[model samples]
Target: MSWLQLKIDTTKAQAPVLEELLETLGAAAVLMEDSADQPLLEPPPGATPLWDATRVIGIFTVDSEMDAIIEFLEAQLGEQLPAHRVEVLEDKDWVRAWMDHYHPMRFGDRLWVVPSWTPPPQPDAVNLLLDPGLAFGTGTHPTTALCMEWLDSLDLQGKTVIDYGCGSGILAVAALLLGAKEAWCVDNDPQALTATRNNAEHNGVGERVHVFMPDDMPDMQADVIVANILAGPLAMLAPVMAAHSHASTHIALSGIIRPQVDELREVYGEWFDMDGLAIKEDWCRLSGTRRA
Candidate 1:
């Protein structure tokens, strides 16, 4: 089937209204993206943030009356429609298209993050079978990749790992696949916890993988603790992270940009002997051992 894609460039204030209007006009789906390459800071819990310049896209059946929809939208706004375009979008297997581009990615020499649909390039290497879903961390982003590479370098055999902000449970599951005794995944989002659990099970390490929310996380020390979250939250959770660490525990923290390195170093240094600063593109990963 063919569809009509309506793309509109508008202010953040107008984006939500446009989405609602498009839905009212029988759009099958609506998506909003940043028109400008703006960096988005973490929003307060339960808040949704949008960029100053937003591009709103609406998908509708090709046979829909686009002219009537546009007229109604403009009449509702009491102004002419902003810069927009409508194009025919031929139907394609979007999932297959995505999988075609997302090939198996190797982190370090031995660890491979492979899509569930694809075969591992190195069958003997540590392979993490994953599919990008509702949660993040399929080992594609620089931040996640940096953390995965660091995990690859470690001797995780018989170790207990804690993955704070565990999106999709990639790090925790990878640790298990690499011979870790157990992995505990903690995230604030319920969806993330679900994704983590599902991914862990998909890799056949379900019994060894535990999922928890931040508030419900148990008070237990781990041999290794890895957190891939924004610098701000990383800083704020320093005490919580420290509470879960004992002397000589290895810790890896990513989701930091180059500019935020010094502050994070200072914050995490109090609990751990922070040292290794790995840079990938504009992102940085910090690693250290827990202080006595």
Candidate 2:
């Protein structure tokens, strides 16, 4: 299907207004990119809070109703956004174009990212199938990999786990296969639940992995809580996730860049003791036990 790519040009001061407005319009994916900087998993290193001009590109799937949606959004944001700057294109080849650039990535001692189209290697390594599609959290991404690496090193023998925002269910499935007794996964997206279920089955842990939609989260707690999601949501969900964590429970978090660590840490610090944090490339992951 074609998509309305709303490319908004704005000063640093106006970016947040545009961002908030776009979300109000229900943008499927809104990515703000620097005029000169390349795409990144996280904000660039030493990147100031809002230092430069940028193109806030918002992608919305276009259908028969999409024209109206675009018109409505244009009218809603036109005064604040440059309407002429919008670009309309058929995004059929977008993900395929990215597939070439992301063949397969290996993380730590175990965990190999084998795309759905490729056969998993028979390495002693843990095989993770990732076809992130649109919901994010592919095991190949640096942030996700960092979390998987931490899971690989943990002593998960017979432990219970909760994987919030469990895109593709890679972490929870890995925990079960790696020695955890069982796991529960929470995601608001039905597509992610399907993807997570499929990935768990592919890894031979489907039955043991419990999937939960946002409103239907299980009240049960666990020995560990893992979420590979953006820093904003991670901080907001810390209390709910930490409720499932005991004093000895390990909490693992990802999808945060280097700069956002302090803010995120401060949020989770109320319950979790941030003893060790890991960074790879522009992404970072934090791991710690709950404070007794």
RMSD of each: 6.4, 8.4
lDDT of 1 by residue, 1-292 (tens): 7888788899978987998899888887676667653222222222334567888878888899888888899999999999999988777432354465578999997999888778898999999998765467778788889999999999999999999988778999999999999998999877689879999899999999989999999999999999998899999999999999999999999988889999999999998999999999888999999989
TM agreement with the true structure for every prediction: 0.71, 0.63
Question: Residue 71 error for model 1, in Å?
Answer: 28
- TM-score for candidate 2, please give it: 0.63
Candidate 1 structure lDDT: 0.85
- lDDT against the true structure, per candidate, is 0.85, 0.73
Give the clashing pairs for model 2.
Answer: none
